[model samples]
Target: MDKSWIDWADWCSKPYRAKLEDFLNFAYVNRDPSSRIYCPCRKCENRKFFEKVIVRQHLHGNGFWKKYKIWDKHGESRDGADSLHRDEMFMGSDDYMEEDMVKVLNGWTDKSFKDLLDICNESMPEGVNLPNSYYQAQKLTEDLGFTYNTVDACPNSCMLFRNEDINLDQCLICKASRWKEDGCSLVSDLGPGKRKAAKQARYFPLKPRLQRLFMSSKIATLMRWHAEKRTDDGVFRHPADSLAWKDFDKKHPSFSGDIRNVRLGLASDGFNPFRTMNIVHSTWPVILVPYNLPPMMLMKQPFIYLSVLIDGPKGPGDKIDVYLQPLIEELKELWDEGIETFDASSNQMFQMHAALLWTINDFPAYANLSGWNTKGEYACPSCNSETASIWLPNGKKFSYGSSRRFLPYDHKYRKDPRSFNGLREYRRSPTTLSGVDLLTQLQSNGILTEYRREDLQTRQMMGLEKPEKDPLKKRKHNWKKKSIFFELPYWKDNLIRHNLDVMHIEKNVCDNVLETILGVAGKSKDNISSRRDLELMGIREQYHVKRRESGSEYFDPADFEMNNDGKDKFLIALSETRMPDGSASHIARRVRLKDRSISGLKSHDNHILLQQLIPLSIRSSLPKKVVEGLIDLGKFFKVLCSKLNCAADLEEARSRIVVTLCDLEKIFPPSFFDVMEHLPIHLVQEALIAGAVQFRWMYPIERCGE
Candidate 1:
């Protein structure tokens, strides 16, 4: 990606800029096929336009407090500068969140972010008037402090999703937009829908040489900007919460040196819980590349596997640099190539997109890189719309379902009433998670587990219902109609709440122990305090008081041992004793001091005692949280059962307890040995270790050697 190609207008304005203009024109001419050319700046004569407006009867829309502005280094508006996005409880937000976060964290009605975006992006009312361009949208945000933009179906039937101060128009100076006799080409609109889907057209009419232009920096930048969301309402509208955005940014890092390092970018609008987005010059990433880039040339449409770069101010977890490393490197490489590389920068031709695939090679202990359905296993987007597996584009027969969506391929099951628009669209071409990212995914889930143990007490509280038993099962409860308030999807997501069951989910990196009588007695490698046992690990220096009085020095093991003050050993001199882990056996009878000095001690004195350093396995932390949480959780079912109305569901709920107790035992050591006999085998140990963090999550490409 040559730097010269970056500011396309810079060269186009100069008549004699032959070499630069010639190459860029060749790359840009007739290239983009998605009909996404920059649109006309001046609103002139009327032309063909397709528009949509859907009315939403006023529902219980909960209102939020205020929204703040995100500013850049130059003091430009980031998003909604001085305005606020009122948080609505009912209608959408309620369905996605729990009662605790809604009422406790930030008081509101109830709703999910997904549903909120759907409502926010709905067709605008006919009478509402608004600004019509991207910069205008920007200006509206800066001056008016609030804004909204619209999408038109000019030449297409689908609704055009719009935003208030986002990408509504093309860059007027640059060739980001175009003008025509009847209507202007919208190729340049920076809207998420057009830019994200534009890459697909490039592949439709492929060629041998054209591929280089396709691989140009311009294309790379386009992809970088296009990666807006991890999933759900990422296309537009702010995200509902910080947890959702965190998951998004984890996938998209801010930067990397290689392709394998690519992850997803996390983005959200309204009030971001992360707070980074609301500050000055802070950025975030999201990983959600549905497919690779190759298919765009052949298929002529959007495929996943495209990462994006977003300059924050629009939402939380904003900015898209994590996906820009490759593009930036390619540009610098071209700059070094002098005149030979032909200024085909990311702006002109090679713009790229970045995203993170859900399942990669490193995460095999969980699932594959997502595929289509056979039923019962994978999520059928057309059936139940819970997790990300629904839109599995990397599989053999890639497809997407509309409305209650599901792909028609193999490996997943689909049921009605649950699935919705699973096969949303074709992922980027040849899409599959691999290279460096596959390894990173495994490392986070794997090696991280080696360090900390999560207290999953939440799961046992009956707060966590088992992860939906296959999307195919659409059984609804008659209890709600019979007088109960409502039926929850998880009834209780014990596994989600405290995650007491996932004891090793957290990691303990170090351990240290100390005794007054036996100074610096011992330390374990795993203990962070082990260094403290050596004295002040994070500190720079320490002083030894007795050393100065000794005059000869404590460095000499003989002098250091046996009472530096020249008195008899504190433990020795025929002292009283205390029962310990046998180490107290060293208490009397003229014993040598803590330090071993060959010349002054018997053979046993030289032997280092292992008892001082106590090692705790990761699994040891598991049983307590899981067991305790579950024990408390069981009472809820008992109470529900005793109520006389939940006999049937409570009866079935019996198995949940057995399964929970059994899982807890597998990862955690039981308080008793034969106690396992009284319980079911599900609670029995098949192996000492039920699950090991996969290598990829803990160790990916860049970290292979480290």
Candidate 2:
């Protein structure tokens, strides 16, 4: 952060600075406790000595890198010109330059650059070593063609001040100045103006970055793994092969025509870099991931490319659409005109077309992007049909409230005596088949409709008319109009346009399970009602019960409460125990629930809950059927997370999730549904199509907000 470090150092010695006697006294005063100063001469080199005589002798002589001729031969040196020539000689040649660069690249750091020239002066090289400065190394890297594509943007979350608007002085939307008016000359002068300048986000075009990926032959070939190397076998190896994908492909034949065209998945979320959870200010980064890679390499961070940073003191929220304008414009171009790209593997330049296959995000982000109400009962994205919900005793209502009725249409829970009598018999009618049809149905609602059907008014005309009082209520009435996704010409199909982030979903489900079990109010601990239910399930004695002063029983569930096995006993047990599929298993790592932090339970903890702990450890305590159902769910998640060659197991896993969701009454307590309705729509749609087992899971964006 300091500018002084960037200044170049002078190599020549000062003329007549001090006579030999004065220099000797000055050097003696600066000597260490051992009465010796370090010698910089070629022979006496940088070594601490007990004798002051040795240090003085070295200073009078020439060092390998530091020539003494500059000082001693000052009068005969053509006013330091001949001494300067000799100084160059002391510096090494091109051969040693290569070795220096290798060291620079491998051991480069902030301090390394600052001390580079100093290190060269200290080095006693046998051969000529070039005196390479920090700037020279930077110039070398630039000559090697290292560059980044950067575009300026308005400090406010307005349009990019790029292209035709590059010369504009102010933003069109917010009227914010394109550049800071008060240009500070010194670091001391930098205050509010510099802070404002810092807020101006930079846009890095993803097109060039994607092209660069193809420059590396090893990575270039891996980019085509999904299309060429992966075995299809009619399974869901990638989203391209999913049922939703195939449906979209069927609807738009021309778009899916080129198998070689790149497919991209977009993802974005707001977060506070400061790690202060309650802070309202957050930075949002829009990221694009190439889905052409295999499952193992897909989610890796290095492969994830940043398209833009939405600089902020506050999150963009619903207004995230404004920041996405540039991305959307680029995407439209990529989809339509394509780009001329060089492929290293094929060793040729080709026209590469890229499409945003889908977006991956948590529920809140998905809702912000898709304009779907994830909080409502009709939250199911696949089927816009009405879902069953019930008013609970807690003065709140929940969908799939009754566990007995939580199953698939044909599931036996519909007849189970414990299920809501006659309630399970209610059947819902089907809704529209496509997003277009769904939009039509929503538009027919009188409150949202700008004009009557008989009036024969267009939507544009409706917008011109003054709305009735209570505009906020009207806006609330029609969430569809607020959604930008419906307007995108490319992403017409709502079902497959956005994807559920698998990471968030698994983390959310795990949090719910752990919260209820651990009895932590805000974390993955079990709620009071869930604990009471567990008591009713006939395992109350597993915990410790204390007699209070009032002679009433006080339950302290710590005895049975789940804790992290500090020694990883659970992991050992899981590894040794035979799984239901008769496979020997090794979990990635041991998850410790007890090691709680401000973020509540971590991903690894949730992983353990779903994969090993729930399936293997809690079998005896819970009902046999419930244990089996949980194990089934866990296995499905495990398969989904795995990197399999074929989609056979993936499809089967998806189907099992739907079935497991249907049997939730047997698997989990009723309180879980209170949180289920708010899950992202992608999970709901995927479940409806693949068999209703998977959609019941929740997304974990709230964890980030916390």
Candidate 3:
């Protein structure tokens, strides 16, 4: 080989070998003890004290026995092996790096080709990396840098790992230790207490819908702190500052309280009664359905989400990240049918506050004339007269002069006999008026055109109107209560989680609930058998305990609904009422004959009667006590009904009649009439209506009057 080619082969054939040999040569040339000053450790000194041949023999494991143990007091891991309480900080698997790797290699030059640049760079570019990106990369490198955030003060709230677009609450207790450095959270000094607590209650795979609920809860609190309210004077007139919502949200501050949390409990045990009823009714945008939650979840709808915000010092962590997707998808389904969600924020709960103050319950304003007031009209207080629209409501109509921008309109109240000063005494009049139109048009026999006929008819009808009635005349109907409805559309995806359904609580369900119960009953008992939330709701009992400290009633589904497949089968009502409504008259005992056939009755006209048989059993793969409890529902409802208020005849309540079967392998008392206490899902009709009517109450009159 030529000289140039020979040198090239030597240079290319060895890479790792070259690097190692080069370092070895450098070490040999400077063989003094001081030359091993790269490290002051004993390990480095031992290697330096020995010559190259001895070191090479020891490293190659060629019968050069010097196998002394090296103790890692700090438990530092250099290679990829992970120790129990230590971390692997370096990639130390480079010991097998091959030497002479270039000769047979086709890509040696290409692999290190970065050593060749399109153009030479004499110096580094200034500020090549951005501060934000650099810091962001650094933030994710260490566990010491990690922090857990709380969604709310409640322990039941789920937790998240970091800040994101959504808010998924992470268990504050488990994450307390990660936030000590921020001076924002009490991350240290808590003997792993929070970690164990978090382990006891944690949600995996954060969901989006739940995340939004966490943030929404925070917003609800701020809204209650600031809202404009006025007393209801029978006259329906309010002061200027009292009414301002019409245009305020447009320029709201950064801390605007947009999320309104008109909260009720959100758990199966301490569930909200209002939302439970809505789920039973299959109301659009109201029944929280998931993206693809099975029909089973649709039956036992979950309750309202609780929105809470911590008021004091942050107890343990950074801002809790919570997921909000699961809930959002459910809301979208209602729009398919054109439904809406209600802004049941704290602002709507004014009646209670008003009652305490002994002020009017509500008040509103009614302006008659509004327009860009010209020379004969008044100018806008904010902008000059040129820009505003001019229109008139009934009361102030008389003072309003003609303007090019004004449009006249009237409501039923405008014709009512209520006078506010002279505001009530106005008439629709523009002085240049002469109503009598006399038309003379000769009809052409061949074709009396459409325009000519229309003109003749208009002229003939100019003076026609049912004569005006006196606005001062009082109308009795005004005092009578009239039914009004408003449309509210909200979507939810919490169908299966509602404790009432899973636990077999029927007090809040109506006819619709009964129907759903029966439908589920029609299926095999092997389905829907495993829901632990059911046991907490009293579908099964483990010795009833009265816990005064927590204000709770306890039951265990494990005692009954448990089946072989690991499902809790609570008792279910076999019979159902015919009317299919919340009314007490609709309650019917679902009859599952001893032969396992569910029964009900229908008259000769095909109208369902009070009795019949349907083959029904509470079967579930999960095998929980709640599923088994369905078998003895009559006894359960009787005991439950005995404790609840008498809404209607318990015998007719369809919701009470449908049930589950739990506790085949256990024994318990029938029903405790002495301590027969049951709770209602919703305490007020108005609140229940609001939850159920979300998008369905589309009638404007049903909504609260502004």
Score every model by TM-score.
0.18, 0.61, 0.18
Best candidate (score: TM-score): 2
**Alpha-carbon RMSD to native, per candidate:** 29.5, 15.3, 30.5
After best superposition, candidate 2 residue 655: deviation in angstroms? 5.9
Candidate 2 matches the true fold with a TM-score of 0.61
Cα lDDT tens digits for candidate 2, 1-706: 1112112133123321123334445434423324333354456444443245654455444422243332321111323222323323323444345655666447767456547656765664432234456566545433333333355555544455566776666666556666555554432246534523424554667677777778666788887775678765664445555566557567667766755577776777877766666766788877777766766666566677777677777776655665666677777787788888878777777777787756667667776666554555455444444444543343243434443332356766666544322234435333435666656655665323211222213332444223233242333332433444444565666456666555667767766654554444554333444445444433434332446899876655443234444124433453344444423223323333344321334565566567766677655444566557667767766765553324445445545665576565443444465534223223434533322122112222223233
Q: What lDDT is reached at residue 317 by model 1?
A: 14
Cα lDDT tens digits, model 1, 258-377, are: 221122211111223344545554222222222212212211223222222222233211011212223333333322321221223322322232222122221111111111222322
lDDT scores in order:
0.24, 0.52, 0.24
> Taking the tens digit of each residue's C-alpha lDDT, what string does model 3 give over 443-488?
1111111112232233225421111231211321111110000011
lDDT of 3: 0.24
Poorest 10 consecutive residues by lDDT, candidate 1: 477-486
Prediction 2 global C-alpha lDDT? 0.52
Residue 160 in candidate 3, Cα distance off native in Å: 15
TM-score rank order: 2, 1, 3
Task: Give the CA lDDT, 0 to 100, for residue 104 in model 2.
Answer: 49
